[model samples]
Target: MKIKNQIKLSILTMPENVPLARVTVAAFASQLEFNLDELEDIKVAVSEAVTNCLVHGYSNDRNRTVNIVCSIYDNTLEIIVEDEGVGITDVSKALQPAFSTDPERMGLGFTFMQSFMDNLEVRSEISKGTRVTMTKRPQQDLAAAASEEN
Candidate 1:
């Protein structure tokens, strides 16, 4: 699917901005044919990714920044969240279930993103940063939808 629209936002690494990221993404995704459940899933996935940036990436350092990019493509929506904090050393291990750098955390961020979105890709460099790209495709029939709209 071709991209129809996109938005980019940069916010301080604050816990309060997590909701802002989720709501902004969900609002942008609403332009597509996603159902309420699908919108909720997108929001959850965005929340997890952003929270990881604040908690794990920046270590609760509110002075840091989080960048979020959301793109709408016909029936699909892509969301990218990034942070310029200490990057993950083991991307493969991080993707595993219940694996967290912080012992106090459950480390289910990647799991939630995987379960809620259709595609999840992560790239990180030590002492550099981490970028998480997630894509969601609606379950509705695009052909049927087009015919109905016409």
Candidate 2:
């Protein structure tokens, strides 16, 4: 499929980033034939990620900006959430459901992303920042593919 347009939005490391995440995700989902389930999944997953960056990554420090870049290429939608804060020291245990640095956090953001999107990738450095990237593609049209192949 031909890519129509790809959009990007940058947000500061503030609680407001949560709403921005929601809006940006919805805009991308609007381009496809997503059902309620798909839409909700995307929203929840993205919200959790953005919240993680704003809260944990920046430690609620709104002075820093969390760079969120999204691109719709080919049949795939890619989202990257980045924060210039303390990077994740442990990757394996971080994705667990109960793993969290804060008492109030459930530490399920990455897990939700795995459940919602087709692909989830996380990268970070101790002093650099954390970047969470996710990619979801439009459901494959088997009928169209078959027709084209024939």
Cα lDDT of all candidates, in order? 0.91, 0.79
RMSD of every candidate to native, in Å, equals: 3.2, 2.7
Provide the lDDT at 31 for model 2. 82
How does model 2 score by TM-score?
0.86
TM-score of each: 0.91, 0.86
lDDT of 1 by residue, 1-150 (tens): 687899999999889988988999999888888899989999999999999999988989999999999998766789999999899999999999999978988989899999999999999998999999999877785568778999
Residue runs of model 1 more than 4 Å from their true location after superposition: 142-150
Clashing pairs in 2: none
